[model samples]
Target: FEYAHETPKRNKRKNYLTITTGAPTKRSYLCVQSILYFLLLLNSVIAIIMWATNWYQLIIYKVQVLSNNSLNVELWKNPTWQPLLSIYIFNYTNVDRILEYSEKPNVKEIGPYVFREKANKVNVTFYQNGTVSYQVRRNYTFLPEKTRGSLNDIIYTPNVVLLSAAQMIKEKPWFVRKTLGALISATKVSAFNNFTVNDFIMGPEDWFSKIGLNLKRALGEDVPSKFGLLTKRMGLSGNFTMNTGKYNTDLVGQFEYIDGRPGLGKWEDEECDK
Candidate 1:
């Protein structure tokens, strides 16, 4: 009876095939896990790249200058856009009537003589404390096309030097006034002078200025050599000390000192000086 029960042999090949089929499901699950991990790694790399790009943009925004080492220094040294000066002169229309008939002076306003001005920083000295000291030199060039009147046009203007001198010495001693009158008579200086617009604004040293300047010097008065509308301001500006915007961006071009003084002492109040 035992020999009959053991007669049926098990199918070993069928069992092996079933085991191999089950192994394929496990392999598929592992492949899916690997795919998920690769997707996660790709997403993380993209996020990191975006963050770095944002950081680089922030750096650029913080330093909005031409050079990384210097903070808006080049632009401060030389401005791209130059300012323009427009001058208007009063033309004496009825000088003869006013002088001969004692009539009120008739004046007519003329022009818009335009000039382009260029200011350059000179004698620049940079300090280690993020400050810069320099002087500004201003140059003006006449813009013929922009001017309303021709420079060669004759203009009748009052003798500014003579009038100013008369007013200054009016309160002085009689001897001083008599001396100035004699000087004016000797020079044959008139009450008004006829000059070209160009000469009046920027001169070849008019006769009145020369004689007036000499008289002023004889009186021991300090005065400028030339007298014109814009001639006095054509030179270098006073010494200026300013922040270079290195430490604080808001302090660029702010004044620290004018000439050698921290503030102008001409005012009565100390706060007004600043």
Candidate 2:
């Protein structure tokens, strides 16, 4: 009988074992894929929740200049017109906290306090290149939800307003000038609320903390360029005194102070100051 070499049963058995072990490996791979899918789903759910709750908080303060006398936009933009001021106002400040972090500044993001336009807030009038009068009708500071106010609440109109001074000066009609020259600015502001700049802070991370939070230490109430300092530099000190009121705690309160004119007649004439 021709002895044909029979294939070894042991080798054949070993190959079968190897093929069978692959089933567990396949199961493990499927488990890993399932875990990855679950993680992705969890991430998606968290993103949706964040979008609905905390992403839409924003406050906008609209600036409007209205006068009894018609203002020529073209004329106001004249080269001779002085650049009065770029009113940099904010609702609050946390410079003391920001200063703590220089390199590895551990920072935390706070809130979305919103300002709503409302009536009976603050109104200032101007005329003859001077502030004729102003009124703090109602306290403007409020929590975001409290911003339900009329159109007149947020619009600012002034008569005899002095925008800035480089050296010069507008010619309005007599009636227009007179109307704008009135000492009292008319608005829907309320008299019941007379809060100052300091009354509205609920907490360090509240609404006021979120609006116009200035980090610049050199500006605002701490600086020499404030109303009092600038006047003092011009040798016009002792001319007037200002009585400070409380600030709005709801939104951040910016320039809000009452100055008592001690007979401004002592101010140097235009030619003399020049």
Candidate 3:
């Protein structure tokens, strides 16, 4: 018998095409990680560059003081503001009553004489050791609008010259004091004098001041030729040396020396001299 082999029909291959979103594969994840790392590195590099650039600019503008530093130097050398100066005077109305009648002196407040002070840094000299020396010249201009009283207003007050002269000789020998007292008595100078505000503040070019100046000169005292409340300080002050902030910003404008002296020697006390 010829039996035919049974032929099993092959099942039709089912081709079901389904598409769905899912997490990235390992290769794609690694690529994304590399891109993120590249971006982070770029940001870090940019930040470092910006920090360095800002530091350099700050050093150049703020810290370093050189001839080429135009902005700082210009502002320092020539200031635009005019500062105000106020003066108050006390007038003794009852000097004679206090001296002769033994009564309390009547005191009166005179004024608030305002003035516009102009300052200039003259003779600015720079040294190689990062130091600068300069002299400040000051001038006062009366501002009548801001003043409570006139400069020509006359008022009576104690004689400052006479008192100062007496104080100077008080500690000296008794003979010296007596001789000076005789000289002062002969001049007919009283304990009080009438002076204008201008004369008192600027300086009184009167007979008393002239006589006092002459006597002090004769006595070999180191006193100013002209005596006034603010006369001697009206002109240029002494020379001052300061750091330039070239190497150290903290030391900028710090006084290295004043009038070539490291410390002031005008006071009697050692601590006060500095």
Candidate 4:
């Protein structure tokens, strides 16, 4: 009886040891599982952060590219009237191409007048006293029908003389008169490549509209609807005349707001305002 009782006690002690050991093993497994879950969560958070940053950068780059492209297209289309005038002035005085001049007459000054003609080109002479005379020609020949309009009618008159105007005077006041004389003297310089009727007709707004149309066609349904809406709101439609008047207003206003702004001709700003 004693031996049987001792054996039962030993068996009970063994069972207790087994239960304790198994409990520790189970706890270790649980701990490992919890660590793995934590690592997974951290990785997911890092991935989300990287993805968001990339998306933001992409969006910013896209906006910048779109804006720059739009501006470039506008410049290409409009080519600014001042630059064209500069080119014309350069051509008139520089080249020996002006017909009817016995010699390359020294053009002492230019402007305080707006002069334009339908001929391949036209020449305007500005004397010392501010009186202006212009001749129109087709292929270097005076075309009576084409040149019928008065200087006021034909030329898109300038608001200020290229030299005597306040803006030019202020920006280069000391050299204003001298620069005008030099420009006339140097009229025989190279012709301006970008000046064209297309540039003359198309304004900044027209350029944007044309670019938007082309973009729309290229992108088709891939373009975002919101972008299209924005373009429309910015007046990127085909009606250039409406925007032309506003842009002209802004241009004139720029000169007016500046301290040394030139005194533009009444008809010059008036025509553009209309």
lDDT of each: 0.81, 0.31, 0.83, 0.34
How well does candidate 3 match the true structure in TM-score terms? 0.76
Steric clash pairs (candidate 3): none
Best by TM-score: 3
Q: lDDT of model 3 at residue 212?
A: 80
lDDT of 4 by residue, 1-274 (tens): 3555344454444444442333457788999999999999999999998989988765644432222243332442333432112112211342243334445534423222222322321233223332222222321112334332222222221211222222433544465457545654565322212222222222223333343344444534233222221222222211111111122323311222111223333346754533
Question: Could you give me the TM-score of model 1 versus the true structure?
Answer: 0.69
Q: Which has the higher TM-score value, candidate number 2 or candidate number 3?
A: 3
RMSD of 2: 25.3
Stretches off by above 4 angstroms in model 2 are 1-103, 117-132, 141-274
Q: How many clashing residue pairs, candidate 2?
A: 26
Which 10-residue window in model 1 sums to the lowest lDDT?
Answer: 14-23
For model 2, the run of ten residues with the poorest summed lDDT: 158-167
In the order shown, the candidates' Cα RMSDs to the true structure are 13.7, 25.3, 10.9, 26.7
lDDT of 2 at 156: 16
Pick the lDDT winner.
3
Please say which candidate is ahead in lDDT: 3 or 4.
3
| Poorly placed runs, candidate 3 (over 4 Å) | 1-70, 217-223, 266-273
Lowest summed-lDDT stretch of 10 residues in model 4? Answer: 237-246
